[model samples]
Target: MQKKNQLLLVVLCLILFGTLNGFGQKNQKNNENTNLKTSPKLVVGIVVDQMRYDYLTRFWNHFDEGGFKRLVNEGFNCKNNHFNYAPTSTGPGHTSVYTGAAPATHGVIGNNWYDKEAGISVYCASDDRYTSVGTASEAGKMSPHRMNVTTITDELRLHTQMRGKTVAVALKDRGAVLPGGHTANAAYWFHGADEGDWITSTYYMQELPKWVNDFNASDAVEKYKKPWNTAKVINTYLESGSDNNTYEGLFETEKTPTFPHSTPNLLDKKKDFEIIKYTPYGNRITTDFALAAIEGEDLGKDEATDFLAISYSSTDYIGHKFGVNSKEVQDTYIQLDVDLQNLLNTLDRKVGKDEYTVFLTADHGAIDVPAYLSDQKIPAGYFVYDSIKPKFNAFLQYKFGTANVVKNFSNYQFFLDHKVIKNMDIEVAKVQETIANELLNYKGIDRVYTGHQMMQNNYTKGIPYILQNGYNQKRSGDVLVVLKPGVISYPRTGSTHGSPQIYDTHVPLLFYGKGIRKGSMVNRTEIPDIAPTIATLLGIAFPNGTTGEPIAEVLE
Candidate 1:
């Protein structure tokens, strides 16, 4: 009887130990798979603001091996990628790049849009409810609420249950806000003062992290106090047009268009800091801040995918001030190549080479200055804003018996006060048609279609050039105004985007590092397709409202 009882106790002990051992092994396997499923240790998204597709080759000779060369030689380069929408501004560019949806779907149509509901112009990143954490004004009160769709960064956070870190740094607020997505760990943008060091709102965190405070307090601005100067020889930049030309706009303190800028004291003044937006160093500062964020956040450290979005804002500034063809633009690219090399080197040291993924692309490209194009007899000319608006107003008065039919005209978008039309009992659709017809008569105007007409028309054959790209009904204007060939909307110093021309739409898309293929795709791909591609690469869910498919060549 004693032997039987002892045998029963031994059997029970054996079963309990076996059960516990099985559970432990299963848990260990789960933890291992969880680490594997977390995706790349780091995903770095580098967006060069206003970077043209051709510039990559144009400045290729000057690039260091580890920077742009590493991306081109080692990564999968999408040669013919482009933004597939009109009004390709900075805000929409960043939003689309990160979200993998165009302005039509993302809801960030322009940097500052005339909100039909509010009846007031709303900045893309502005949120009145959020107070600035770094600055006094609401300038820092920005968020991604306006962005309707999820970004790749948002997906990374979601997949990790918000354990992974995501940080976006740029010189511009919209550049930072849109790419950081709704649930970013932190988004920092330069405000251009010793005190204005990268500001953010409480939306991300209540207080600045200790690392960020230390970085800000370091007084890095003192480095630029030694007088701004060109990093390369002027003559070596033979690819660009002559400096100090009539086409190029003058810098604030520097009289000539050439470099060796001696305006360090200008740093103390707000107006001078505004000029910093036009120089290449603005991008350097942006890169510096990005590196700081990466180190401070300890991104990609644990079992969560991390993302760091860095946008080089100087290209847009240089494009605006010097035009696309100026030596300034050329030099900026050359300098940027070196800066990119440094950034990549830092990434190699910080985030192991095969462990992280990097994708580099542009927001939008810029047109050659209209003045330069006209000089070259290329038929390019500035849009006659003064002539067109008054004519439209006169036509409106004739049709509706009032001059206030058009409320605002900017970025080729004409917003009509529907309230006034309703009160006056005027036919809004008829008025829009009349304005469209009149606009078509102008020299620089090509074709004009009412928003209703574009929505209904499926016959793309011989459709207007501007309407060739995808257009979403919700974000576009009441009347889609198409500009004639070789016509730009910029009236000020230099060139502008927003046209459906190849110059504004064509941009580079290169993917390098872990899991990326080493080949090129010349087939034309839209910008919205980028998000879906990233989602597939990381095995994350597709962003809502995405109609794009991942590039089949790059995927495994």
Candidate 2:
């Protein structure tokens, strides 16, 4: 009897130990599940339009401690970030940054491209199916339907079952629309009419929200119409070359391109509210609108992650009007630094300090004014599109014994009239090769690629690779043209970006906040990497047609 009792007690002890071990295992599993579900409250993608990579270093000393300086000291900075495709215009830049795909896959080749089917040029975001929601103007008929693939924001919304909110704000419509994706909660851009109101399209909603209406009624543009002057004294902007250069474009009101000018004349005479976009005040207005969006939508206040895309378009406008080496450009950067500081401060207070993620980059970087380069004795010249198009048409006609064979010559590419060519029984490939060979002989032309070659995926490395990434057979032109280094096809007065040169392709890229490390990486990264990096942090699948790899250095 004693032996039996001892054995029974041992069996009960073993049973109790097994139960405790099972409970521990279940607890551990639950903790692992919780860890996998964790994510930041908000993700902010800031695109400073036309920002060059050197701007951070160029303006480092002038930057405030809490603004650009803070980001550099406490965030992961990709010092050598670059755009991977050619035709680095606003539309393609914004679309590529969020889609993780190039223009070839995303179908936004440039700001505007000649549509063969429509037999006319088509704007990147223009959709005739939708009407304006906030204003009577056609500016509101914008949507992201042209984008072929899903964006990072779209993936986030899908992951959360449409619970996540995505909002975009900018001074330009394409800057806001492309990054907001198709299923965004709302996308807003400054309309600059009847006292400057924010507008949207029927693609997102049938009517403007009550908050937007109230904000528009506030007459925000009236506040920015003050006597404009430099942020710091004129001489302090030493790196900008000179203050009054003939290369800069003057405003409608000002005689010379100097500062301390007032905008009351702009509003008083022409009622030109559009003038404000050319100044730093445009950046301020965009920031205010973004803050309103965050508060109004209650973004980042819930468990699911939200996205807010802000593109400061005034920089591009200012850069275009005033050359990169002008006092106006320098002053604009200084003022933008303050605006950035205020924005980060607000984000810290609204969404807890480390609960949000932010990345600041640019749509594209601008080239130095060709005139400025000429003065510096650099071999730079303006390749006049007007002069080239007529010659290209004549050349095509000479080859095919028909007039109007070249339908369009824009965006450094030629569009052949395929319908006319077929009727004339002209082989498209032969015409493309002929144009390519002839275009190469043109002055300031570096190399030319035929549409047939691109369509067949027969391209060499380097610039050809970039052209291939930007080429969409249906949307792009029939013959691709690349200009020599430092050559621009736009106005000689200021600067523009479209080439695959280092200056146009290079841009600033910095990442901060949740899941980010306080370090810098010198790795070569491209615009498409931005989307995949965000997706990786959120533990979501990459955008559908993603061709970019995740920036591993930024991931936690």
Please state the error at residue 321 of candidate 2 in Å: 0.5
Off by over 4 Å in 2: 1-37, 389-391, 458-460
Relative to the true structure, how large is the alpha-carbon lDDT of every model? 0.78, 0.88
lDDT of 1 by residue, 233-263 (tens): 7777778887667887775656787766655
Model 1 scores a C-alpha lDDT of: 0.78
Which candidate gets the maximum TM-score versus the true structure?
Answer: 2
**Per-residue lDDT of 378-462 in model 2, one digit per residue for the tens?**
9888888767667766876677786577887889888888888899886999888987899887898999998888888756468
Residue-level error in angstroms, candidate 2, position 220:
2.6
